[model samples]
Target chain A: MTNCAKPSANCAKRLVNSMSVSNDAKPGVNSYSLRDIDAVLSAFEEGRLTPAQAFSLFREMGPQFEAPPGQGQDAESSNASRLREALNELDSLIGLHSVKRLVREILAFVQIQKKRARQQLATEHLVLHMIFKGNPGTGKTTVARIMGKIFRETGVLERGHLIEVERADLVGEYIGHTAQKTREQIRKALGGILFIDEAYSLARGGEKDFGKEAIDTLVKSMEDYRDRFILILAGYSEEMNYFIQTNPGIRSRFPIHIDFPDYLPDELIQIAELMLKKREYKLDPWARNHLYTILTKHASNLDHNAGNARFVRNIIERAIRRQAVRLVDKENPTREELMLIRREDIGEGL
Target chain B: MRRCIVLGKPNAGKTLFVLHFAEFLHAKEVTIKFQEPVAAPRKGTGVDPEARTGSAACSLDPVSGSDPGAHGRNPGAGFGPSTSEHFKTYKIQDAVRDLTGPRPHTTRCLQSVVLELPAGKGKKTVELIDTSGLTDGIHQDAEIRRAMSQTLSSVRAAHIILHIIDASKAGKKGAVEAMGDVDYQVAAFAQMRGGYCILANKIDLPGARDGVKKIRDEFPGHIVIPISALYKEGFKEVKAFVLREL
Candidate 1:
């Protein structure tokens, strides 16, 4: 037999109103029948009604359910853990000492601004459009990607994904078309960072080219979106400087310019070791020395586009493949032999 | 409108093919409808398809009279109630010259143009949609990913799928491979559906002949047409395919 009360007008409202007054069940619910209570309870249990709906129904039947506290605290802690993980990932990256420091500063600034907003204080505008000047294969793209994730974790962006486009993605062939092309990319990058690689190429096509139109569209979008999205233009140092010099408006729009220097030979070696460590591979003493000697040679012969982490990656990957091939013919190879990259495995060229 | 979607990786000449194909059909004015991802009032991920802003009407002057066989076949095509009358016409030369570029990912959002091809005593109206490029692996940009997903959904709804591959760049290192994993997946998925064709674009460039062989090798059972989209080289076959499918 169910314990529901008899039906009456305003019975649901009265039961809900009496929830804060008493913890006793059926104190105000005298109208509903036992069968009605059973049906409603089963509906709630079957997921037909939401918690709030079920609670309201229970209250109307003169039963009170108190939700325990600490749920907010649990959510906050989980968010903090995610943020910690993202920052730790950023810290684990090799080199880019200055880049890490800049990211810390930005995070602190954003945090302070958020705190100020809660106190009803006027906060400083955070315009994070930046210029990243470096050689090819540097950590511009990598760091930008990390920063996007960090920003998303910290609530600075709705979605912290990185959209990487080159000049070809931005510039259209004819007049009025460049704006459409650039705007489309911008629209896609609304809640994230628009990392334009080789951005200087937008200015390379000379006068009457649609590159200028693309630039104009980009600037307009930057102004329009403001803090909603971060735009990071990356390119080689000299060409990027020339690009900004020709387009004076760009320098003012991008207040943060970070110059990524080439990694030293030792730093490159550290990066190489880190890469190898990630793959659970080891280098023999002879192979390590050979790798160092090759690095030294490449460092000496560095061109404008040299000093690349990507080059190191290629070398390591090739060495791993070579090592596999080397051990393939060996009968009953030991575990140590399988894990090691020998001197011959390290290729001659970078 | 019966939708024919042009899809591929970036720099695959999808946009060029769309405009040149429009020219092939002798469309005077092309109204391009841009389907942007705008948030809905009730649901967060709800995409209201009929936002209908920023649509451009391009006038198509210098209509091609070159195809004697395809010309004057149908007189009253694409004027039915099914055809949308709101599009702007563009000149054929102006549209071709402006629409085609040496860029990747030029068309980001879904841009649909209603074009009519002459058929037996009438015309068939088809909505030719140009979409953003889809790259293999995960894209870092949330916007690009969203657009790509949207493009995929659009692909499922489209009647005809024209998959464009840059024939010139197919075999080149760091270029769009002749048959990338994503390409293979899309091709295989489209196999279950109707009217899917691969357009081996940019045959005017060097190494495209090899690209053709590579494409044929990768997509063994599919129809692959080799053409220079810039010169309208293999548009006749494409038109025939569209006609047969539509």
Candidate 2:
């Protein structure tokens, strides 16, 4: 067949005129030709259509004799690739299995609902409201970040992000001021998870306390954004209970409770070793046992201080210093020698 | 039932003291119930202009019921309705209801406890009112100030006042400094023409001995007792003193 391709200057001018006409149309004008093309292109970009399917659809639509040139394609592809990279990074960092399972299940459910929406099938709305109650340094913040990623993966969120706040951020000094501060924090955390650490501190003072205003505002926002936003309140067990019970309004909404128990003695030892390994240091069996013993003793003595990774970190630093001081003229001791930490290195009465 | 108010500053162990007092009263075989605020629809009508507003002008109805203390005098009449009112009205009804309902002729005398312990005593039903602490940090707030003022006005109603101090921080430089700061508020309550007792809490701590001494030296006339609320130390002495004096 003879090629019919030809440079038509009049056609190019008509294409530009058509582009301007489409751009200048009234907001609600039914420009079916341009609208259909845009819809098909968006569907393809969103991965609803494969390249072959898009090509077939493009052919079916037929080439417009007066179509204008489009803008850059590289920027859009790079953005999609960047989002994929972020999700992969998050997936690798979060290690808790149960937390991961919960997040994946939520994401899968959301995807199912999205597919159902496209099919116009009857599907119930899914609401993922969760409360994380645990002691400090137990990966509450990390879990929140993973949840953001999971939401983004499920298409519930366009860009997964997390915002963490404390009692000081929400509370105010004067009456009627705490509500404004709490509302501002909610706005900052609008499209993502809002994490409130030490939330129990909000209930410290009596009725006249301004913290009550923050609580009221938080409860109202939670109701207002039940679909889009997730609020995670965390603190000591007893204090969190008091915080929830202090206001009858808050007690009802937050029902899903996930408790993170203190890490076992062995778990703490393993964690310490992991931390040391990250720093390119090896722990001898004796040193590991010594660290475990100290952690166990401390855990037994105090109701708190359990699963406190910080305590282990401090002990590791002390042990490292002792080892450094005890080593004589040995230049870069062997791995075994470097790993071997004696009782003296742990110090007395640890 | 006798109602007594526990008034102190922040960190003065008011909440802890109230918890212990409730436990103590429960151990004494007294059936204690916490009364929540009564929800009543607001009345649209205004008070009658002819209604008596003066305290002295108000007359006590001379109806001789089983409650011997009912018509004596309403010490809390002038003060407006507060959270304490729930406890007060509940105690009154709880005390007198058994006497009037079904067991009328059984000589079942009802003893109501008010945080403001009235001067005269019949059947003693004690109510403990845990007032907000009157410390320097909290004294600046208008609401706290008003609550403290209202609490002080009703202080005379209690047969005994327990002044709780933080023994652990007693003799430190900041502790000693804060003592002088709260001296005015303390003097206002201590100088009141009413019975008062001092409690040096946190005795389990190392410096509690010196703290007790400091309090004893500062407020000489009032009775000072060293205690540890957390450890439940010297609580028996406190209970004995309350029973003996009030």
Off by over 4 Å in 2: A1-97, A325-343, A348-350, B1-246
A47-69: candidate 2 lDDT, tens digit per residue: 22322232233333443321112
True contacts kept of 2: 0.00
Tens digits of lDDT, candidate 2, B113-138: 33321111112335555554444332
Candidate no. 2 TM-score:
0.44
Interface RMSD of 2: 41.1
lDDT of each: 0.69, 0.54
How well does chain B match by TM-score in each candidate?
0.77, 0.57
Q: Where does model 1 exceed 4 Å of error? A: A1-75, B1-246
* Candidate 1 per-residue lDDT over residues A87-178, each given as its tens digit: 99889887888988999998998888767755557877778999999998779998898888788777678678899999889987888888
TM-score of the A chain in candidate 1? 0.80
Which docking band does candidate 1 fall into?
incorrect
Q: TM-score for all predictions?
A: 0.49, 0.44
